[model samples]
Target chain A: MQKVGILGGGQLGRMLIQAGIDFDLDISVLDPDPNAPCKLFANRFEVGKLTDFDTVYQFGQTVDVLTIEIESVNVDALEKLHQEGKKVFPQPQVIRTIQDKRLQKQFYQTHQIPSPEFVLIDNKGQLADHADFLPAFQKLGKDGYDGRGVQKLTSPNDFEHGFDKPSLLEKLVDIDKEISVIVARNESGGMRTFPVVELVFHPAHNLVDYLLAPAQITPEQAAQAEALAQEVMLKLDMVGLLAIELFLTKEGKILVNEVAPRPHNSGHHTIKANGTSQYEQLWRAILNLPLGDTSAQSLAAMVNVLGASGHTGNAHYEGVNDTLGVKGAYLHLYGKKLTKPSRKMGHVTILDQTLQGLEEKIDLIKRSIKVVSK
Target chain B: MQKVGILGGGQLGRMLIQAGIDFDLDISVLDPDPNAPCKLFANRFEVGKLTDFDTVYQFGQTVDVLTIEIESVNVDALEKLHQEGKKVFPQPQVIRTIQDKRLQKQFYQTHQIPSPEFVLIDNKGQLADHADFLPAFQKLGKDGYDGRGVQKLTSPNDFEHGFDKPSLLEKLVDIDKEISVIVARNESGGMRTFPVVELVFHPAHNLVDYLLAPAQITPEQAAQAEALAQEVMLKLDMVGLLAIELFLTKEGKILVNEVAPRPHNSGHHTIKANGTSQYEQLWRAILNLPLGDTSAQSLAAMVNVLGASGHTGNAHYEGVNDTLGVKGAYLHLYGKKLTKPSRKMGHVTILDQTLQGLEEKIDLIKRSIKVVSK
Candidate 1:
């Protein structure tokens, strides 16, 4: 049996465990919390810190291959395991590039990948040196996800309350629609990319509010985006799934924003809309098995079900019955215990034979369901 | 949250766990073996005899709704649970009628459903009394599955090894191609049926060897078969996934063979070939959630991976890599620790845009893969 060890035990880890059953692969997961949603399904569950070198190393030793759910894992431990001949997908190098905004921006510049202009800020002293770059977007180089660890720097006064650690500043460009491209590659370099999807962020939370599959872009734009995403995969020498978040400017230019090494939240719609789900494709690519068909069976829209603000006790979903009554609306709750504002608890994917029909169903779902705390 | 408890933890139970995730429904499972494949995935797992009334009753109390993976479950306990107001799909009464060959045949006759002529035989002494019906097929239905507990009685000499218990004696069916229809219905009487699928049985095991979706038949014949299956569901008042197996004679007549009231193995192809998998449809029907799209997205062929004869030990799959090397061939292993001859371990489903292409791929999967005991 080929054993796979996952670093975190959140919903992504839980879904990966579900997908592992299809391949009959043994899975082991490490999480600090014993009641993590994924613990029940994985073949073996271990409680440990994701960033602890010894814990990550011990976990990696038990599996033939290692992967991760959250990106804040101990990279040095993974690098050590890879050096000892363990298969670490996405490669530690790729994760290193993505884990830090400075390294990621440097990679894009070195490879001539289309991206926004940015400058690395080592400290508050460095911010003054680049004072000309004021009114830029300042993002912490590490430990940032889902719109956290980021701020808009309008002047030197902003540096007084800025992050104590190093950060990167990027020129803010006016965006048309936030888009993402998910691609999978095998060890043999065979690549497959799903249709590009446009993301609409929640006005206040800045989290994905909704996703539109096969983003309504011109043929030329779609072709260019796809080519660029595939090229990035090849350049990174990545195996398994890679999700590239991009910014499409009003001027019709595409710029790379960031990339996730594993199955990203952006590709969750593929579970219901495409021939082969992103989880299944990730398994196939990691195992070097032949990939299945990647055609879209229908147009799909995905809406994130985050915890309603100010309700933070035990979790309770109101209007669940009404939501289920909607035609073609599929709900997935992450089996979470507590609910907090802006916390991801679950998601709903609405699929239809046509895009317009899906949009209508999505609108109904948006109005019908509320993920609250009781 | 509404919890569902399933009896029998096999591949069907495993697939139910996957669907349960999408529905955000909690599921518990009961199986005699502690290491049943679904034990690790279900929210709760209890090891007890499926036919033990007390064990089944205790398992039933753990969930709001109850269903079964196989029909051999203890009907008396389920009846008691039903009296207590717990929902048991394919009601205890329906299971009782379907469990016994004699009762099942009588119900069919009473409903005027098309079936072969048959008589009840208690022992060898009774067989001679019905001497005119000599050369009959004797089937002990109560505990029969996958061609077990069935025999072809040619003459009085064939009765030498008579049944130890009462059995159903039916006229031999001159089958052309065996087919099955999976019908799903909710408590509200809303129902849907999948396209008829042709079944090719293995020459020795008599188990389904291959299944071709959208059986090659005239549209009129397809509609007739679908209507007949629907009638059976309504007559039984079945409120779950019901799989009706049938025989198509050279005369193009459809004869009802039997029915399975839970997620049947024959519908596994729907996982990849249809808009909604049989697993998801079964969950929706039982929960009274709106049924999903059941239309076939593509033509598909499913080949069962049965353990090879003359080998019984630790399980090991041969030619898995070879089979997986083919495009569009999906292998599903049940995570069984041991393999015995004729035991169903897994299956491979090959899907394509056309039936011809699927057939070609099916042929390759059959030749390349061997499921054998180590």
Candidate 2:
């Protein structure tokens, strides 16, 4: 019966609301967009800047527990609310540490977590001093999201692509595959991890293009990935879902790439493919309830439905009927009204008993669906 | 996208909204209760009487298609809407027949569908003329719902229990097991049926208590049950979800007991246990989209969380946390505010790869959870 509030009512908040409805949870959402996806669905919705101290603090006062779908929220307000006896999941300090790439790297280094080596830089001018760290990626210390604020710097000639403010130069790893492990921790310190998922990124968009659950890896590798994810979550001392992206180096090392403090794209297939979905897990963690089983029900694949190129107007899904025709394909449209090239329109989760079946259907799904504008 | 309007906004409508949200379908609902379950979540909600001619007629004009979660709506309005080109699924005529017990029985007999033998009666005085049909059930011609408006007659002394209006005296079958098969048909004639589910009724309340999917029946029996359900839907010319409740007589004959023209409690487990949920199938059928695969993802059972016998006030769920601790247990609260004795508060679905695991968990769930007034 707890009144829960969420910051940022985009697709993640929308999906969380879908899961929360099952438990009849009283959920409210605050998003700056009056036309947010959760605008029409949330029990109560208030349009306000998530980073405005007064806006967030006032919103926090109306709910028993507060959480976020995005990480760029006003942490100071959350800290004040936490001190005021309201439950703020993922913890204010955890959010603050993750809000900055430099702090996140430092936390990993301080904990001896096997993440990629990194050096903090104050501005683009400092890139020259880190020439020895060439071939690294420069990521903005804050305000970056969904692959937007990181640029590859192979040499001094690429320095112009580096962030001009507080940032970090992260040494690129020789990755064989990119995988993610989603872990959940409750207030009681109960932790659980979903099956490791293999991610395939869009070449140009730097976003997850498609992913396979129970990533093709030896049990030892999976256990190691799960263990590393758990170590990072425990070290952060966070309560809620955490998505840890990792690099499976050619040398067979499981090195941490980055971590998201909430449900991540890697786990979206869980709604249909796992024993419990990440969205449901978030609710359990924030509500201080028992965590759910994270076992995969079957081999599954998720393909993001990005907006079709050259389309930008009222959204009209092409081939949705055909996609629905494919057996085991579950379409989840975010209810967004417009379409712009590469925008996250929705996703489809395909389930099958065999890896071969999954591979074939995923190919068909990728070729058949497009989000265009009318 | 086509707009959809629902006649009622109770649990069934709430669930349909959940499924519809996945497809980003535009949905609206009209229920007399301002606090209807779908009020907070539906794309649009209007507080209007579903049985009011003006309310139902005017409401139907605002959507591309109209449907119902309950059958006691203004069918005359729907009939007019259907004639005027708006899609009224289950068809107004189907609702008309199914709404009256006498008409439903006659339709079955006329279609050569195997069902309980029955004789139409004009009043309670006519019951004495059918002494040979003693121990039969006298169902009122209209307005009978759940277990109400129906009474058992075993002798002349029980004639007082019969309705004074038009009714039917149906010979009760030598019952063994009660089962349901949900069938879906679309505008283009595409049809699909979910696995047969065995139902256990509450002895005191004529409602389904719990059910097991792929009901513990022989393959031949299962097929026969499914075929009978299909026959009923085909005869009714229904386009949408139809829940066919059948009586598996002691002789192993499958006889039609009754039918509901929308999602039923027997198919609730499909939400998590099947490849496609009944709620989703309803949307597919109504939208003229391809029917989804109805294969069971795993062996599953659902137990309704009814309000405790002595409770009647604002509702509070007890032991939800404990019930949640059981692996594979999925809780779905209906969000109803009151706790009346025998009222359906919610349901918990238990899934497992083994039947024994489901049976054991069902017992535990039945014991641990209680919906009470607080």
Candidate 3:
């Protein structure tokens, strides 16, 4: 059996450990919190700071292969581990490129991948020269996480209110929808891609509500999205799974939004909808095993359980009885005890054979599900 | 969070720990082996003898709810814990009734649950008095684990090699096929049953090979099997999952064979084929949550990966690459390093909408998979 260690022990690492149990591999995880979700599941859970180079390098030395859930880990240590023949996935160079928006866009430009045009500003003073990108989004070139670092600018007024630093001003394109494609690559160079999925955003919150697998799009558009996602993986030449978020322009062109080189949110429905889940695929790829089937088992949708506003105590679910009764719905609570406003507590994957049935399931979820604290 | 303590930590306990991770429950397990399958996953893995009254009773004091993966545990301890207000599922009385074959058979006869007629023999000398059942199966009424306590007394010669003690000689029925139904019951008296599954045995090994869910039986037969299984749960008056193995006689009658009060091998397909798996249902019943749907997502079959004969050092599969290429196949390997002839190493589940497609998948598995050791 091979030993596989993970960089972070959050929900992604936790899910991977759950999936990895089926294989004849030893799984370990490193997280700062002893109470992390992956603490119990991983064969070994080491408490350490992910950002500390020594902590990550020391952990990497004990495993045959190393991969990550979060991208904010120490890349320098990963590069050193790779040099020591530890089989670091996504390659340290890949993370180094993605950690900064400026270099990520440069990599996209160099590879000629279809993406929205972006120009870099060294400081807020340089914002005037890049005024043509009004209605653009200014994302801090480094250290951005979740949805925090990016600020939408409908006008120059937005710039003064956002982070004043070296940033990439991405020209916002008129898009019909956002979609994602997850591609898996193994050490043997075997690769496969899941069908494109349409990311549906909540109307008021503007965060993703659920995703429809094999996005309801023209056959040509679906092909375009999948091909573009594959191109990104091939260009980056990274092992393990990569989730490419794309914007389907009103004109029907596919433009890359960003890429995550790990098991991702867009593929959460895979656990119920696909024969091979994204988490399992990560293990297969990094372990040099065959990539699993990425085909959808049915028309699938994923609904996230966000922490309820005005809740700030140990988490308690409201209306789970009514919600699960909807049929074909799988509630995956992330085992986090606390609840704060808008936190990603968990998600539900509802699968059906038809789009209408999927929506009915989704509606049932929205009406009956609430994540609160008591 | 609610604390759930399991009595054993074998495969069933390991799977429940895996399934329970999706729900926010603080899980713990008591197993003597430090390397128990559930050790890595349980929130607290306590090393203790499951059959020791003091150990079980003390462990039960720590958790709000108690359950078991194996039945040969200290029921007296569980009874005491129940008396003290700790929730013990499949309650001690139910276990007491099912643990003894004679008592179990009597319960069926009293409840009018169709079963093969049986006559109890107090000793080997009494076997001659019960000579009318010459072709009966002489099963020891106590301490039976696996296939050790039962034997087919086809002739007087066969009796020389069977368990010579107080036992029940059950009249053998002309069986068409063997099937199983999994019934789930909760504390609120709410109940549900999975689709009837056809259990297939390997002729050479005399052990189950795979089982097909929604067994290929007339709709009436399917309904009859499910009703009988539900009746068993109702008669036992237990709260937990019960796997009732039944014989479908040539005359089309559904006769009860035996029952297990926890998750069984027959329901393994539910992990990938049903809306909710049997493991998840156990937690839901024990935790007093709403029972999940038992509806099948597709036609399904599961193939057991028995350890190969000849070499045995550390377990390794010979041909996973070609087997998984069959697609729609989910391989779940128990984390056992040593493999010997006929030992269960793991199982592979193949699911499809059509039985024809399923057979093709099963054939692919049969030809390409071999559980071996390096």
Candidate 4:
């Protein structure tokens, strides 16, 4: 049996385990938490830190091919494994460029990829020198996700209190909508990309509230974004799935925001809306199998079920039953033992034959569902 | 957490384990073999005979709800468990009637359902008394599947040499084509049926070789079959997926042939073709959740991949790569350790926007692929 080892055991890893069944491939997952969601479905489960070289090296020994669910894995260990003749998808180089925001922006600049202008700051002292670049968007070099480690600076005083150590200050372009394109590639250079999806975030929390596929953009803009995503994949020389976050400016220009090197949150809607899910596509691409269809059968919107504020005891889903009663509403509760405010507990994807219909159903789901703690 | 215990640890159980991830429910499976296909994915796996009352009853004690992959499970133990407050879907009484051909036929007659004429015979002596019923079809009432334990008797002398006790004799059906309807129902009598699918079996093997959805039948005939299936569900009070096999006679009459009380193989195409898969629907129905949409997104055909005769060593597929190259062909391989002649190892479902195109693709898939053992 061909065994595929995954580096992290988050929800993406959990979903990948389900996709592995389609090909009957054996799966082994490594994560620090024993109760990680992917552990139960994988063929073998190992509790180990993702960034520890020894742990990753040991996990690599048991599988025919290796992949990652989270980008914050030990890249040096993955490079070693790749050199030792083990197939590592989303190659080590791709992870190296994406793990750090500073290097990621530099890579885009080096590749002539169109992205927002940014200035790299080595420390707080360097920020003083780039003070003229105020009103900048400050992002930590590494370990950032879901709007964390990112801030908008409107004055020079904001730079003085910016993040410690290495960071990047990018020009915050006036955006109309935040979008993402999930693309898959094989070792043989075969590639395919799903339609761009516009992300709508919660007004107060700034966390993604819903994902709208076939982003409300003109055909020309969609085509340009798809082509740009393909170019990014070729430049990265990446395999497996790559999710490219993009910004649509008011001037009708598309700029690269960032990229994730695994099965992404934005593509979750594909599980119910498309012919082949993003999880399934990741497995097929990594295994070098022919990719399945990527066409969506309907308009789909996904709503993340974030934990409500001031409730952090045992999880209790209020109004979940009522939300389930809505036609085409699919609720997926991540089996987490605890709930914290701003933490994603689960999500629901609603699909309909028309965009207006999907939007109406999503509005109902948004109003009727609550993820809280008892 | 509501725990569910499954009786058979095969592919059906494995698929259920995958679906259980979405609901965050715990699943345990019991099977006679230690290396059952479902062992790798289920939350807990126990080795025990499915037909052993003690084993089944003991397994049922660990879960709140109980179900089965195959109907051959011990009904007496399930009945005892149900009496003790365990929720057994497709109730034990339903399984008892469906497990044996004679009992199943009797139940149909008792309910005034339309079926072919048949007679139950305890031994060859009983058959001799009905000698005038020559050229009859004889089938062993128990342990019959995939054309096994069934034969056509040309004369009274034919039953003298090769005779089995407790068999049923019926008029040989002159079939134009075989078809099946899959229906799902909850305990509250809420039910829905998928579009009818026509089955094309291998001539000599008599195993379902291909399944074409939205069977090429008149609208009246499809309506008749669907209505009959719902009536059976209401009569049986089945609370899960029910697959009713039917024979379309040369005269265009539909006759009920048999029933499977779980996610049937005939509905596998729904995984890719329909809005909701039979696996997901079964989970929802048994859990008392509202049934999902069973409408097809496109036309589809499912072809079973059986191991070739005289080639049974280690299982290795020869034409898998070629088959994968076909557009819209979705392959599902059951993780089985061994392969023998006529062993069902996997299946491929082809989907298309049009029925005519799907039919053409089915012919291409049949001609291009061969399921051979290493």
Candidate 5:
């Protein structure tokens, strides 16, 4: 087995390594935090900044292939490594484009991919010129992640919320629902896709609250979503997993919301719902192996387990026993020591033959379990 | 979460740790082999003799609860730990009884479990005294594993093949299919049985060649098997996973063949086929959490990947890429550094909605993969 190294050893890396173990692949991980989730199981763990070029270069040198769990990793070193013949999946160029919101939106537009209308702004003052683009969102072009560096500007009065740095202001879509399609492309140009899933986000948190697999969409809509995801992946000319978040407008139009170049939160339910998890598909893609079946075996719903409000310090789980008592509920806790408010702690996957049963369990899980500090 | 310790660090321990990662449990393993499979993923790995009293006792002191992956571990140390209020399950007494063939057989008879008739004997000389039981099997009372320490005696002329040490002569039932029902009992006395599975053994090797979930038997027979397994587990008062291997005689009678006090080979397909894997079920049992659902999500067949007959030394997999291309095929490779003929290197699980499709994939997997030397 070839040695595989991952940058940013958080829960995604932890899960990818877990899936890799089945193949007996030798895996190493580099993360700035010594307590990163992958530290315990990775074959080798290097504590270094993922964004530091020298740190990434040294780590990438030790492996035959390199991939990332998060897109914030230093891509220049990755490009150099790829130029020198080391395999880097979702190639550095793709990562570089996805890392900047401006480039990501531009890439979609340039490829004729349907997305929301947007205008580039250099500073908060520039927002004054785009008042007609009101009822929009001002998103920083760089370093914005997981609801951060993003603000809704519904009117001229919201101009103060805009970033002073370069940003993109986009008109908001009246979303009927949000959906994600995970697609895997191998080096041989073989591609496979998991069933499209609906993502219902927390109204306040902006994080996925729960998701249903085999999203309740018409066959034509499902086909449209899959085709759009494939198109995005093909345009990037990428080899790896791509998570395409899309919004179905109330007017019956599908628009690309944003794109994640690596394993995204939307695909986590595949660990138990699909024949092959997104993590495993990433491995197959990066290794140039055949992509696995992406069909869902049963209806599944996943609820993210975030740290409870006003909780900090060593993490403790409450009602785990009771929650597990629910039939078909599978709990996964990322082995993190702390539990700060709203931090991604873990998730629970609920599998049921019927969507109603799945929804019932999801509600039960949400009400039963809490990640708190002891 | 309490710290857990496992006595053996083979593939079973490796798998247990893999499942435990989901719960973020702190797990440690004690095994004599420095390169034990669990060494890579266990939170702590101690290279020490599992059968040594001191080593077992010292290892038990480091964890809140202890369990075993192999039956050969030092039971006296486990008994001592249990006496000292440390949790050891299936409980040391259950392990002790299951460890010796003589006691295990006697236990079944005393409890009126539907097992084959057997007679305890002191030596080969005693076997000749019972000519009526000539076609029985002579099984060593202790330290017998896999297919070792057992010989088939068809007539008085075969008495010379019997063991000289204390052993048992068990009457062989008329030929029929073999099946396994895995029952789990938690500390709270909650019990659950995985759907009965049929095991087909290799005629030459006497080990499970492949197995199918939801064994092709009448519902009445399946119920009987589940009832029988539950009866055995309740009688033993064991707290953990118990794999009950039984023979469905030609007369339509189910007879107990043997039992293992930990996760058994018959349940490996559950990792992807069942609602909850046996590994996770075992964790729930020992941890006193509620037993999980054991229903099959999809029909599944598992084929063992043994080391090729003429290959040895540094292990390598042949045709992994091609085999992975098979739809619904899931490969699990134990991280063994070396391979020799007939060594259990890994397994491939083929799942499908129909039994015919599953069997076809199983055959394809068997022909496509081989464990050989580099």
Candidate 6:
């Protein structure tokens, strides 16, 4: 058995280490937060900043392979490690591109990948020149996650109040529906994809609320989405899991919305529904082992359980027994201590054969459980 | 969330902690082995002998509830804790009775539970006096597992070399098939039982090699097995998981073979084939939560992969890729280092909707994977 180290140790890393238990491999994790969920599972927990060059370099030196759960880690150290003949999945180049919104959009455009039109603003001074694109989105180029770095613009006044950091603005694609595809590629270039998933947003919080695997799209549309995802992963040429978020335009055109190079929120349902979960695929992708089956054995629906409004202490879930009483509901808690409004606390996955029945169960779960302070 | 402490840390404890990840609870383990498989995932790991009174009592005091993964733990410490108003699942008396074969068999007899006729022997010197019990089995009363402390007697010569210790001799039942049913009883006595499973043993190793869930039996026979298991659990009067091993004779008779007060090998298939796994059911039982569904969604087959003959040091599996190539096979590797002949290392689970397909897949897996040293 060999040792592997992950860069950021949050819930994604937590689940990844859980998957690693079935494989006879030694795993370690490094995170700045001593209470990070991965600390409880990984063979070793080194509490240090992920972006510090010395810390990452030292951690990378001790493992046979290195990977990341979050993309905000130090890429320069990763490049140095790769130069010294150490294995790094999704190589440094992939991380560099994904960390910057400007570079990600540019890569898609240069590779003839379909995406919405966008322009980069190096600083707030450059925001005024992009006033022509009034009704667009301003996204920070780096170090942003969840729903944090995105702002909708309607006039020049909104642009004046935008972040001074490097950013990109793009016209919102006229999407009829949002969908995602998770693809796994091994070091040998063996690639497999999960069934496409449909994402429905919560209007009040603007976060993804409902997701359906084996998205209810026509066969032709499913084929088109899978093909686009394949092209994107092949172009990236990274050895790991990639989640491609895409938009189906009202005119029936598919456009790449954004790209993530590690385990993403949309793929969590795979742990319960697919033959090989996205986390396990990432393991195979790194070990260069045979990728297990990526097919979904059943239809699944997912709902994100966020921290309820006006709660800010130790986290406690209410009505868990009631929500669990609903048939076909399974939950995964992150084991985080503090809960703030709209913070990602945990998620519930619902597996059912009928979409209508799954929807009804999802409704029952949403109304029953609430994450709040005791 | 409250913390629960497990007394032993082997593969059973490893699987229990894996199941705990989904629930919002803190878990710890106390095992003497520094390299116990549970050293990583548990919230706390105390490296102390399970039989040492002070060590067990100290560990028990830190958690709200105490349970056991193996029966050899210190029961006196559990009794002391129970007197101190702490919760110990299965209670102290259950472990004490189940630890000794004589007491366990007597418990069954007093409760009118159907079992093979047996007589207790104070020592090996008294073996010959029971000539009427010729052609029977001599089993040591305590501290025996996996084919150890058990002997078959067919003549006077066999009894002459029996163990010189407290033991019991029983009439060997002619078994048509061996089956096991797992029953869970909560604090309020709410109970549930999983479908019966048939176990097949390997001739050369004398160990269970293959298992099939939803055992192929007449509906009437299945009902009888379930009723027997329910009676055994209710008599034990414990709040935890109980696995009852039973034998169906050639004359259509059911006899209780033995009982395990924690998670058992025959229930492992629940991880893949049932709506709720035995590990999860154990948590629900101890926590006094409403029990989850136990219906088998699909027929499942399992094959044990033991260490090959004449192999030791550093475990490495051969042909895992090929075994996993089977359409529905799932592999679970116990992170054990040493490999000895016939030592249980891991298992492969195959799930299918049809019995014919499941049998074929089980055969493919059995011939494909071999556990050995690198």
Q: List model 6 lDDT by residue over B71-113, tens digit each.
A: 9888999999999989999899999999999999999999999
lDDT of 5: 0.91
Model 2 C-alpha lDDT per residue in residues A74-101, reported as the tens digit of each score: 9999999999999999899999999898
TM-score for chain A, prediction 4: 0.96
Show model 4 residue runs off by greater than 4 Å. A201-207, B201-208
Query: How many clashes (backbone atoms < 3 Å, residues ≥3 apart in a chain or on different chains) does model 2 have?
Result: 0
Q: Candidate 6 has which clashing residue pairs, if any?
A: none
Query: Docking quality tier of candidate 6?
Result: medium
Candidate 3: tens digits of C-alpha lDDT, residues A120-190: 88888778776777889889988888988898888766667756788889998998899999999998899
How many pairs in model 3 have backbone atoms within 3 A of each other, for residues 3 or more apart or on separate chains, i.e. clashes?
A: 0
Against the true structure, what is each candidate's TM-score? Answer: 0.95, 0.98, 0.96, 0.97, 0.97, 0.96
Tens digits of per-residue lDDT, candidate 3, B209-327, equal 67888899998999989998988998899999999999999988889999999999999999988878999999888777789889888899999888888967777787888776676
Candidate 5 local lDDT, A1-374, one digit each (tens) = 67889998899998998898887878899999999898888888999999999999999999999999998989899999999998898899999999999999999889999999999988778889999987999999999998998999988988875689999999988999999999999999999989999987778998667888989999999999999999999999999999999999999999999989899888888998899999999998988889999998889988889999999999999989988999989899999989999999999988898977887888888999999998
DockQ of model 6 vs. true complex: 0.58
Q: Interface Cα RMSD per model, in Å?
A: 2.3, 1.2, 1.7, 1.5, 1.2, 1.7
| Ranking according to TM-score, highest score first | 2, 5, 4, 3, 6, 1
Candidate 2 local accuracy as lDDT?
0.91
lDDT of 4: 0.86
Q: Which residue runs does candidate 6 get wrong by more than 4 Å?
A: A202-207, B202-207
Docking class of 2: medium
lDDT of each: 0.85, 0.91, 0.87, 0.86, 0.91, 0.88
User: Where's the lowest-lDDT run of ten residues in candidate 1 chain A?
Assistant: A319-328
**For model 5, how does the per-residue alpha-carbon lDDT over B257-323 read when each residue is reduced to its tens digit?**
9999999999999999998999999999999999999988888898888999999999999989878
- The DockQ of each candidate is 0.58, 0.77, 0.65, 0.65, 0.74, 0.58
Please give, for residues B130-199, the per-residue lDDT of candidate 2 as tens digits.
9998889999989999799888888889987678999999997898998999999999999999999998
Tell me, by DockQ, which candidate is best.
2
Candidate achieving higher DockQ, 1 or 3: 3
